[model samples]
Target: MSILPELERRFRRALAPVEEDPDPLLAMIRRSQDPKFGDYQANFAMALGKKLGRDPRQLAAEVAGRLSVDGFCQPPEVAGPGFINLRVRDDWIVDQLTAAIGDERLGVPAAAEPKTYVVDFSAPNVAKPMHVGHIRSTSIGDALARTLRFAGHRVVTDNHIGDWGTQFGMIIYGYRNFCDGEAYGQNPVGELSRLYQLVRRLIDYHAGKTRLAPLAEKLAGLESRLAEMHAEAAAEGKTGDKRVKKAIHRQQKDIDEAREELGELRAKLEAVEQDPELSKLAAEHPRIGQSVLGETSRLHAGDEENRRLWREFLPPCLAALGATYKRLGVAFDHTLGESFYHQRLRPIVEELIAAGIARESDGAVGIFFEGQDAPMLIRKKDGAFLYATTDLATLRYRVEAWQPDAILYVVDFRQSLHFENLFAAARRMGYERLELKHVSFGTVLGEDGRPFKTREGDAVGLESLLDEAVARARKIVEENDDAKPGGAELSPSQRARIAETVGIAALKYADLSQNRDSDYVFSYDKMLAMNGNTATYMQYAYARVRSIFAKGGVDAEALRASRPPIFLNTPAERDLALELLRFGEAVDYCLKDYRPNQLTSYLFELANCYSTFFENCPVLKAETPELRQSRLVLCDLTARTIQKGLGLLGIDVVEKM
Candidate 1:
């Protein structure tokens, strides 16, 4: 077990004698911010003293007296303001490291009581191409699944693909109206993608043309309002007032947003108008929005021709998606797309109505929640089912099939309200015992701080993004290999293999390293760099440790088989050993909140500690043979921990990078 949990158990026992409810106080026993303070610190004395009307220092002394950490940590030292600092014994650290070297899981114990988890992620609309936006969900979800399983949980990964959405309708309409038969015969996926884009562009052009006048007027109104606000602020000399300044700031923001929207609409319309064929198509499909919806309605209503097209188009789309998944090294136990629940959607709506969970609101079937102006519509007035209906069916199917303790939807933050409503409705349907979570993540923004997109304002394709990362990585790999001490020892094929691994690792790490709730600027240069918290750095650290074994011709298997005693002689070695022993703790911390960044943070720290140890201590030329062997064992442990930690994040480490 990790030191924190063991320490917490001891502290809980110590606190039990003094307080009635000591469970909450255990949270105060956390890792110290500064190593000089100690390995861990507990500040519960102040709060407990305040509650009991006692001096904090005296209470800290009493608690310290009751605490027993004989083999685990040194004597608890009471610091300023009744803070209790506890550092793990160096012998205990050495003992743990010795035990870990022989274990495959690096001494990380499995969960005592594991539960089944159903992770829903990588849900791209099959009719459209996967884009940059899909990366967050896919990477985050895969990492979570990997981590959960490593921690000994039953994990079910389901890719709830958008196979039956309006995007397919757009494709269907485009195929009927504008598909090139020859091109489709050769490359169905390419042709279908082209058609989808063409239809979408025409729809957007018409939509933008219709909204241009109103958007321009809105911009003018916002500009006039901002000018009025500025004039008032100037005349009244209220610029210094906080409220007036706030109002003026709000006005300016409104004006800026309106102007930006108007500009985008104009630009979209201009692009189409400049192209003769596109302009003709735009003029021809003025009501493309409704027409697409009509096609979708027919598909859902079981039109024979539309169903045949859907079946024909689905395989190629799925195959293309499968290839991307293979490149990313992501897999799903089940790919239950939205189309799988088509037959159940209507019955689900009827069941909701029968259960009084849904009712007809203005000719539409919906479930209304308290304090909400709009209800979550399941069926539109035109007798067409909505995503909400399909979602309900999917949820029911999963519950019946998997019986998972928790269901996690790895999706973007934009769908927060939709999930909130869905979960609420699910609860009303009597699924109160299960945990339903929306693992919402933020956008991947370009360096310009907008959603990452192509020059033409379209979302960047996932395949092309991978290709670019790998291409860049290949260049860096070749350059580094050529600059090696032996003058390029790696063959072309070896370089290619390393480039592929490094490139994909960089991409996955770049996304996994960020706080999933915050938008991060995606930069290839930053992510691919060989220093700091990048995957390249971690991989290099692993490679550097392995190089010691290679240079000395040391047998790692014999080294482990000998069961050499690990000695933390230097402060650097001690820090590295301490970090190595905390691998299980790091994994536990990560799974606590479903955040892979926690694991990334831990791996980065481990790598840094290894670096410090490598610089301060010489493993091959120690004063004593025993110390040299001990440091070698430590080096092996560090490499194994890095490899395993990165593996948990769904990132691979090259033996040499």
Candidate 2:
């Protein structure tokens, strides 16, 4: 048990006869905000005294005096307004450390009642390469799964990939039209992505022109009329008749509205033209747009040619995506893509309509809620099922298959409304046993506070980003290492491996360390720093501990195997001991709200505490053999705790850095 619970138990025993409301009393027992206020503070007396109409100071004194925490804590201090402060006894700290070191879990307990959870995340599209945009969902969801599993929950991770979508129709069209066989045969992902991009841009460009054609012509006519009106108004200035002046004003106003609409259309076209690649390709293939619509219609109608192309393209795209997931150490228990529920979509929509929850509105089949302004569209007017329909089918499959206590969709915050409507629809459809939660995350922004993208205005590829971070980390490791001036002691491959570990760790830690709800600016200089709360810093701390054991010939593995007794004999040692024992509490706290930053913060503080103890306490040169052994035990536990904590965060540490 942690210190807070133990203290609360003692307080409850003392307040049982007088206080009946346990929630308020429990709330009173919290970790002290400041160290000087003691390790934990209990203001239960003030709350109970108010109920009993007695002086709170007297009640505090009675409760402190009645407390039977002889060896565990010093006398509880009742300060102004009946604030009760309790400090753990040094011997109690030593006892807790001894228990923690002897146990494999380091005194962290598993959940007494574990729940089954299904976490859905990392939903990358089939044809599109994984990019920086995927980092948050993949990393954050993986960390939550790890943390929850560590706490003994049965977590099922699901990668709800985007496999069946209209984008595939564009891909099929592009492959049939624009693909280079030699290039595609060598690297299918590259060639398919290229074709997809080209076709998508061409389609968009042609659509812009067709839609804006009439507006453009209208604007031209309006501008000519406005020019004449401006000149006429200039000539008529103060002497023109009232009827001519009014007519000119009205005509000019009409021209202004037309110009505004035309300007918006031009801006849209300009934005599409901003991409040099898209601009060139669009100009080269001006007729590609109509072909996209034709292909899309054919694919939806189960065209054999499009189906064959989709089958040929999916394997390589998924293989390329798997490489990025491997580098990030993210894995899923099941990768059920959108196509998996394709057949069930029709049945689901028909059932909703039969059940009277859905009806035909004009041409579309949708569910209309009593208070909702817009109905949830399950089927478009054209006999096609929507995303919400697929999601509803997915819900039924998960319920019948896993029966999870909770289902968390780790999606971006932009789709918040979709989940709200989805959960509402699920409830309406009589599938209401499981909890549905949208674990929304903010966008990853660049330094300018806009969405993170390259200067060319395209998302950065995940593989390229990892490569760049690894190269930069390798350079830093090479420059700062203690290798010989002429040559390094480590081989090139060894350095490269270390750099890869550090680089990947840095990327994951940087993303996981931020509050999930806040958008963080991605920066290599800041995330890869050897100081501050970076993965490099955490790895270095672990390395320092390993180095100490190497220099002193302290066998940590032997210590752990033999289960040495841990005891703290100094202030710094006790502080470090307290932090080390809080590992389970930290993990529990992290999963309580599914926030990985809580775990990061705990690991960071533990590192700082270990640093303080390492500086103040002498291990190999202790005053006595017993003291030295105790300090060594602390070192071993600290190292193990760091590794375990970092591992839980989906980050790894090298023995040396």
Question: Per-prediction count of colliding residue pairs?
Answer: 0, 0
TM-score of each: 0.95, 0.88
How far residue 114's Cα lies from its native spot in candidate 1, in Å, is: 0.5
Tens-digit lDDT track of model 2 for 63-180? 8888878888888899989989988887787777777766767778788899999999999997887889998998899999988888889999999998888778778878887889
| C-alpha lDDT of candidate 1 relative to the true structure | 0.91
Clashes of 2: 0
**In candidate 1, which residue pairs get closer than 3 Å at backbone N, Cα or C atoms, i.e. clash?**
none
Model 1 regions lying over 4 Å from their true place: 217-252
Among all candidates shown, the one with the greatest lDDT: 1
Give lDDT for model 2.
0.83
User: Residue-wise lDDT of candidate 1 within 342-441, one digit each (tens)?
Assistant: 8998888998899999999899999999999999999999888888888899999999999999999998999999999999999999999999999989
